[model samples]
Target: MQKIIFYVVVLLCLVVTKIQAQETFEQRAKVIAENIENITREEKKILKDKVDVINTQLENKSITREEADKMKIEAATFHAKRIEERVAFEESRLNTLIKEKVDGKIQEASADSVTSKRVSIIEVRYRKGNGNGKRKEVIEKRTTSQLVLAGGVNNLVTGGAVANSKFRYWGSHFYEFGLTFNTRIMKNNNLLHAKYGMSLVYNNLRAVDNQYFVKNNDQTELVTSSTWLSESRLRNIQLIFPAHLEFDFTPKKVNEKGETRFRTHRSGRIGIGGYIGANLQTRQFLEYQRDGFEVEEKQKSNFNTNGFVYGLSAYVGYRSTSLYLKYDLNPLFKNNSADQNNISLGLRFDLN
Candidate 1:
């Protein structure tokens, strides 16, 4: 009889405790639902008004059936999105409430002298193996993007050159434009990343001392012209793929809602990378005097230029503006006596 009475008392206590925990959870759920209702009150009404307007327009023959159907889809999409947002908000609020309740119970138990002997309501409600562990929806962060533009002086560095065959290093020009996409490699961490994209690169090299290139069967060389040559330059256009391993030196920030956000300013940024390109076309421009008249000629050809080019590149910058440098590793002219490589140094702008 004594054992039976003890078991009955213990069972009653367990039932009462479960009831209390359930009541607490129900109260928190009610509060979260109320808050969600308040947030969506005006928005829901607006959605209803949109639906009514669409219906009235269709009934009055102000809109065609197809147009009304499209409008209806738009309205439904907006309402569905709003409802999803509300549900997410409610879920976050409920998690917060549960966490706070657990923390408060822990504090109260610690303050009591019988804490070692007592079990907390929160611990029982949210114990291990319980089905109440909710997975929070992850928020997708926005990625930084930009259009990159660079311009500078183009020069040819030769291993060896014939007499009067050097490149006009200062007068040459180079320019490139690219659309760059940047993605964060890790959540809330922006210390390292990969930057890659496609670019249109143009390189122009003007010869020195009124000289121009002539391509023979297996070689190309610079030769002097007797005519009064005003301008002569070689142009190369290439479609290039640029890839960089970049690093950010800025500190991370936490927003008011306790979410981590990276400050995506380009300050204190640096990158080292390489690019490979395919030659689109090459052309030679010549302007000279013939019979007391100005004559301009543009000759387009392969000119024995290499079909593929690749090189090393680097950049250092502050706030989307950087000093850029590139050096080609391979010779420009294939099967040529002169071994010349291209180098460019200039200012780069990253417009985001």
Candidate 2:
């Protein structure tokens, strides 16, 4: 009686296994069919979108009617070919599933769960394309960054006059380097931007007529050096934060989705702003001949230079290069017979 019961149980287990296999095969087949249908529908939708964009271009007079017609025809052909290839790929997958079922290799699972996932992935990829089998270009970014570099002549205007300057025009120089961030001011417009960043500024001045900066009690003055000198330079190092309101004149463009986008640095731009910072260090370098020997002296001191500094700056140019100007709003030194303000004019480059 026990042997007869075992035979009956074995027969029932085989029947259940066969039924599950059949169900799995049918479910997988249905998933593939649904995927095929989805591919066709998605391609059609994408093609319609492309046509809409082309029509928009035609209405805007951006493209001639002949060009628009040609574009539409190309879009249709491309989508049709995509549909054919994709359907063939799905059919091949279905055939593979059928063969697996015949070989008793397909496992029992819910195929509907995978169907949506696969279809969604394909939809994302198709949407990224521009109906020409190529992905669309990225249109815009709300914020961008640049590496700022500037160098040029440096001088100080004494008594608000350049003619009374004590520094040599060709000998003195300034250099600046920093990283800057530029953000669009409006949501749908790229005509204006706010640019802000930090910078390290090195301002050097070479006094004229063999003169060097001297600290006289509570005052700073330029006195004649006793020794014949080849170099007499006073340098001030500063760390400053700069902010600007920039106006960009780059033309806007329309994307495949008929959305207007702005691209910067493609045309001329103007930036007007200011900077404020504290003096980091001040030093005077002297190179001369004394006692029939080459002598070099580096004097480190405050020399009554201003501790806090603020300046007005502006730039205007095409693309990445611009003519830059900066002028200090405060005196160069705290205690002095005549007030002298630092000024700079040079070429500035902003590399994105």
Candidate 3:
């Protein structure tokens, strides 16, 4: 309530000031034009010097073609910004002048004109207000929204190394990818509300370890050989949903220059979730060897060999996504008393 009253008082003061500042449109336009001319003259002089250096450097081989071109581009951009600033200054001056002139005219005219004008040209008026505050507020809101969207991508592209191995380890052919999406459900000057997430992924896992080659070479002479390489493959599909408790730190607001900016929000998140799914496995492609005459041979399973499947999951990552490693507590082959399991290190893209 106090803040609101303070703002209202400030607005009243602005209106009073605006009314008193009234002057002829022609007079204000002349002042604006003069200021614009002065700005142009100064900028033009600086631009001339800059262009001279640009040309000289381009001709002299002091800088490479790429470097010179880059310099030119920079100068061009500076020139453009200078032009925009001059234009803004002129426009602001003109607006103040025009508002003063029009207001004075309306005040001097019959009372009916003032009423009519307020209903039409001036939809709102406070003792100190001229609508500028409201306009500025609207612009600020739009700018903040734009900044949020532009900066939102920083949340999606995240990665972490597999640093440990428990029932889970890192450094395998294990990998995961997903499309994450977030929507701001709520936001305020002090807080923001949002429920955003991701859906679906092409999860994959594969690894092969063999010791036959080592033993085979120990006996073979000139023609080095191994017991033959045995291979095992584990593959699965996973889907996880995460809900995050995020605390935002830094805040940002657009400057008078209409540029969106941000400071670090160094936030922390505690996410809880589970992965519900299974992986298809190929236990082994069998083959045989003999010392006597060779017999008939059988081929192996293509696309998919093993039909073993199981589910396992773990928790990791921050708000938007996390790195995860899950292991299968189940065996891959039936009746095959081979102790085998799946160890997968992957990432869970958050869809909360």
Candidate 4:
């Protein structure tokens, strides 16, 4: 009778331990599920934020609706894939824990035939895709559009005897700014692209000598100023439309659509092309110290300069930063006694 009582006590203890182990497994599995869900929720928020940006871009006309939609689709697909992978990992972990618990229960109750059977139960119900289709698919056409702003420095250089003359470039005074659209030309070949836009270009030349430009019929003569001048600057503003065929050498990144997008101009790029536009305004700016006060003077005139201008422009560099050079095929002044062409070199920024 005592032996039977001892076996009864042992059996009762094993049953209690198995019940406690099952409860612990359930709690752990619940915690794991919650953690996985939290991480997925954070990732979804990030992807949604990107979609919001794309929508804003569309509303602003910075990007086309098709482009914005494409971006949204890509973001959704990417987010879904990430969630699936993470859930799969967590599910595997939970399965291992449950399996260990069951195996332990079986071992502890091995003396009884009723409680020693293996328990195998796996529930897998996962939602897939962006809910747009039965099978996952990515967009085939990949395109991007954005508003670009660029600004850089400018200077002038000449050829022949004038090149030998002492000339000064006002480093701080010369610059150009443009609002443009940089787009890929071919869908597959992202390396080739076209950039076209409107720019407000300001070119300032500071002569070393106390000289000013004088227009005589068709002649633009560089003559000395009658009054002593503290500063003499020639300011020319051109409303230009520039176009370039660019080659991007930087590594490309594959998007969700399996299409490649060129790295930014800062990454490495080269552009070769030209521009044709009209000179909007030209004036001579003079600053002097009269008595003890500073005096400023501006003389607005054509100075026999051409109304229309065309130039050859090229740039090479990495990322959005580049070295820019431009040369006018025609003279700055039409049919002048002295033939002085306009050539400028500067740095450029391309918002890609």
Candidate 5:
């Protein structure tokens, strides 16, 4: 009987204690539920406010309605998540406080204490990895071009014995002209250059001089002196080969001011070149002669001279056109009792 009474008393104490624990648990749960309900209400209210404001914004066509709605949803979700995190932190704090009551060693979390761990994320956009949109167009920095035009006239163009001392003659003043074709070969920020052309010349010649001759046949023991015999005229043509390397102020071509391609100028280049030509083709001039026994004035004819034409020309003149002055470095008459220099004033043209 005594043991049964002791067991019953113990059972009664256990039931009462369990009932008190159950009531405390119910009270705590009720408070947690109220807190959760309050948080949910605030979240719904925030969502409602965001939706209303976003709808107003979407009325403007600047942003699409779908885009505006997405922003509203994101804002609401972020706020709700914040509230949920706060609730979970509070619950954990309460549990820690309850545990701290049992042990003095455990530090209790304060209401003001918050989780100090911070998390952030950075994202990279891979718009290019999806696919390239378009191809870029390119522009050329260099251009192609050309220039052409006619130049001035020329006078005093010739090279032969007339300008020579032996068969000295000067009557006709020849004419010359030039043709040029030039294109830019190179160009930079500072300079421009061409592979060919500075000037080109086309030359013509005409002159007149009286002739006097004395021939002696030693074997025949005969001495004859010629009279003043005159010839009709003399004419010639020369192809002037020209080449020059020059520094120009303008990166363009220049025209001549005076004289033909053979006129000697005050300043210019002086280089050497060879030539071939036909001189004294039917050249007639004045002369005096002694025919055997009598000395008399007569018409001495047959003033035609021929052979391969070989000579050289010199240069002078610094501007654009060379003052056409050239000396026949090589003479035509081998042993015609005439060692002479033929000179003229003209222009200089660079062929290449």
Candidate 6:
């Protein structure tokens, strides 16, 4: 009777042990399945984000549509491969757990701990994931930069009139190159902006007669050259800091998510502003015949010109090209009997 009772208890113990081992294997299998699903979802989300960036580049015209499509395909292929590899790893882990259970090596405690502490693939990959499991879209900055180039006719305005100017109208010219930054003024509005930058300005003037500028005492005057003159030009270079209040007419765009974005230099723009700087250098270039030989002379001097320069400027046009006008508020030369201010009209290009 005692032997039979002992055998019955032993049988019941074996049944309970088998049931616990089966439960552990099932729980581990469920955890592995969950891990595989999370890996697929996370990789798909990453691929979608990459495609969105490529599409934005296409829409901005930064890249061709064909290039964007190729980038998307590459991103998709890479993530797909990643998904396959990661899922295979999880499946291998599940297979290992099953083999352990068949060999009676899996611990019931280990399986219970896994169910309570399921591995998060996203946390393992991103580490710094934004807890919410969603990515925030990037937005355009409030301030942007651009390159500016302007060149056109330059002349001096005497008594506020271009017709009364003494310099040759068509021969005089100016060229300017600079870097500028544009900032949106209002938080939500895109119509108004503040533009500021630094520039190097070159202004040239040619005398109507065969003449050149000469410094006499505290004054500078244009005098007829003694030799047969072929060319006479006065060039002044300045370092200028300009600032303007710009009104942009480019219509604001709303994205699919209904977020407002300001796209500048896309349509008509008007800028009214001023610049203040100092004259860097002044030189006179003369090309003429001296005796029987051609002579080229470059004379570098202050030429009694104003050291401090300030001017008012404005531009109006569509897109990047604009009709730009600038007028000096100060006299071109100091202590001169006739007051002459420098003026320029040109085409300005503000390239992004």
Residue-level lDDT for 219 in candidate 2: 96
Candidate 1 regions with alpha-carbon error over 4 angstroms: 1-138, 160-165
Q: Across residues 1-352, which tens digit of lDDT does each residue of candidate 6 receive?
A: 1222222223222211111223554344445544654676677679879998998899999999889988987887787667657755864575455446546785543534533433211101112446699765444467766556677789988876789566888789887756678888987777899999877678999997688999998899989877767889999878788999999998887767666666676678999999998887788999988677899998988899999999999999976668999999999999999899999997776644
Candidate 5 displacement at residue 2 in angstroms: 99
Q: For model 2, name the residue pairs that clash.
A: none
lDDT by residue for model 5 over 1-352, one digit each (tens)? 1222222223222211011111232223224334544555565577778888878778866679789977876876676566647655645544443333334543422212211210111111112332476554333222211111111222221243233332223333333222322222344321222212211122222222333333332111112223333332233333333332222333222225431111111123334344444342222232334465433333332222233444454444442334444444543233444443334454443311
Q: Which tens-of-lDDT digit does each residue in 1-352 have in candidate 2?
A: 1222222223222221111113454445545545655676677789889999999999999999999999998887787667757865865675456446547796644434333322110101113577878887443447776556677789998877877678999678887756677888987777898999877678999998999988999899889988888999999887788999999897787768776766666579999999998787789999998889999998989999998999999999977668899999999999787889999987776644
How does each model score on TM-score?
0.59, 0.61, 0.29, 0.55, 0.29, 0.62
Task: Judging by TM-score, tell me the better candidate of 3 and 6.
Answer: 6
Q: Each candidate: what lDDT?
A: 0.65, 0.73, 0.34, 0.60, 0.34, 0.73
Cα error of candidate 4 at position 65, Å: 46
Candidates by lDDT, descending order? 2, 6, 1, 4, 5, 3
Model 6 lDDT at residue 80? 67
lDDT tens per residue, model 4, 96-193 = 55446436642322223212322211111224587767755343223322222233334444453335543464332444544455666765455787
- Taking the tens digit of each residue's C-alpha lDDT, what string does model 1 give over 1-352? 1222222223222221111122343333334444544545555578779989999999999999999999977776776566546645655565455445435542321213322322222101111333567544443444555556677788887764322436676678787755565666666577776778767667888988888978887787788999867899998877678888878676676766665556554348888999997777788999998888899998878889888989999998865557899888788889987678888887675544
lDDT of prediction 4: 0.60
State the TM-score for model 1.
0.59
lDDT of 2 at 162: 76
How accurate locally is residue 84 in candidate 6, as Cα lDDT from 0 to 100? 51
The CA lDDT at 350 in model 2 is 66
C-alpha lDDT (0 to 100) for residue 181 of candidate 3: 26
Q: Which of the two, 1 or 5, has more lDDT?
A: 1
Clashing pairs in 1: 267-319
Quote the RMSD, in angstroms, for model 2.
32.7
Q: State model 6's lDDT.
A: 0.73
